[model samples]
Target: MSHSIAPATISSPKDLIAYKVDNAEPVEFTSSKGYEERRIHSEIYKRHPHIHAVVHSHSEAVVPYAISVAPLRACYHMAGFLGADGAAVFDIAKHRDPAQGADMLVRNEQTGAALAKTFDNSNRVTLMRGHGFTVVADSIEVAVMWAIYTQKNAAIQTTAATLQSTYGGTGSDMPLSYLSSEESSVAREMTKRTVERPWQLWVREVESCGLYVNTA
Candidate 1:
């Protein structure tokens, strides 16, 4: 199906911000930085019209794993959402700028595009070490689901590590190929449900709260 955002009635950034706060995660925007977020949102929307929402968050496990030299693997079924190979990690250490906030830790537009390109032929999911994550979906519900499931996978891995250390059990050994199949199925279902039905609800909420301004 062709993925595209319909012409929305909401205009001002405040309305968008309000909508985002009420429906999804609470977004922080000072008057000074608020315009910047709005601009970014607009740019993202313009570039990826099909993307209904863009989520920026810090997944605890993913953060440490990114900083470590070893690559982070998907240890649980839920992590399949990141694809069977697991999400590719882009080394953003060179892109770091202390002046920018947590998000800027990934550095400039080049870094962002590089990270996005990692998922070029796939669905939404990318990790930035010490920065956070960026998940793009056709709707907020799908985006939120990806965020939650990824965290669940991380938590499971953490628990598995504990068990392996204490009880001498083997850690998660699921291969990427197996995980990829599961991830595709879950992503399909989420896309259908979130995009077909609840997306309207999300749009309305974001419009009302003005948080939609952060569309980039």
Candidate 2:
């Protein structure tokens, strides 16, 4: 994680090695929340007062299309919410000079602010070009589901594009089967009901596996 973000700028995220999940407090360290994670989360929380959680992920599946001209379409049945919310891309390459070699890192306050604008309008999803994506939701559970669905959509879109090209399709000729707005609404509501089960499972995993339990 430090390779992608400068540690000096981040207010020290309770040493990764020391963080445990047994519901015990830190013995010597003055542990705090994820500094940099809080940085972005703060912006989203402030911008959308109703939003309760923000999820950022560096999904490899979304990377290829982020850096390419091909768009991540609503290609999967389970990813219907993506189409309903409207997906968008945020290219730091376009936001900054090419010679600077942005390296897919939001290096400072200015960059972070620029990235936040990626959620310009109605989109709860935004693709960080050459980086990853950020998902905003009313709950952490929904945000988690959004991250998974985004990657799944990206993978499905990639496959769909590949199949179209292999069959001699060109440019706008690519095949697509996006759900209608009405269909997406129903699907989104149905999907929301299913998030509780997985979220509970994740909570169990966190306690059972000690996944960041040092500050518990």
Model 1 misplaced regions, further than 4 Å: 1-32, 35-48, 69-78, 95-108, 169-216
Q: In candidate 1, how many clashes are counted? A: 20
lDDT (tens digit, per residue) of candidate 1 on 37-65: 33223334445667777766666766765
As a whole number from 0 to 100, the lDDT of residue 193 in candidate 1 is 55
Question: How many residue pairs clash (N, CA or C atoms closer than 3 angstroms) in each of the candidate models, in the order given?
Answer: 20, 3
Query: What C-alpha lDDT values do all the predictions have?
Result: 0.54, 0.65
The lDDT leader among the candidates is 2
lDDT tens per residue, model 2, 1-216? 222334323333434322111222233455343333344554555456677777888889988867787666566566766764357888776666555555677644445667667665646788887678888877878888878888988887788777878885766655466777787767777777789887888778766763334341
List candidate 2 segments past 4 Å from native: 1-38, 84-86, 94-101, 171-174, 203-216
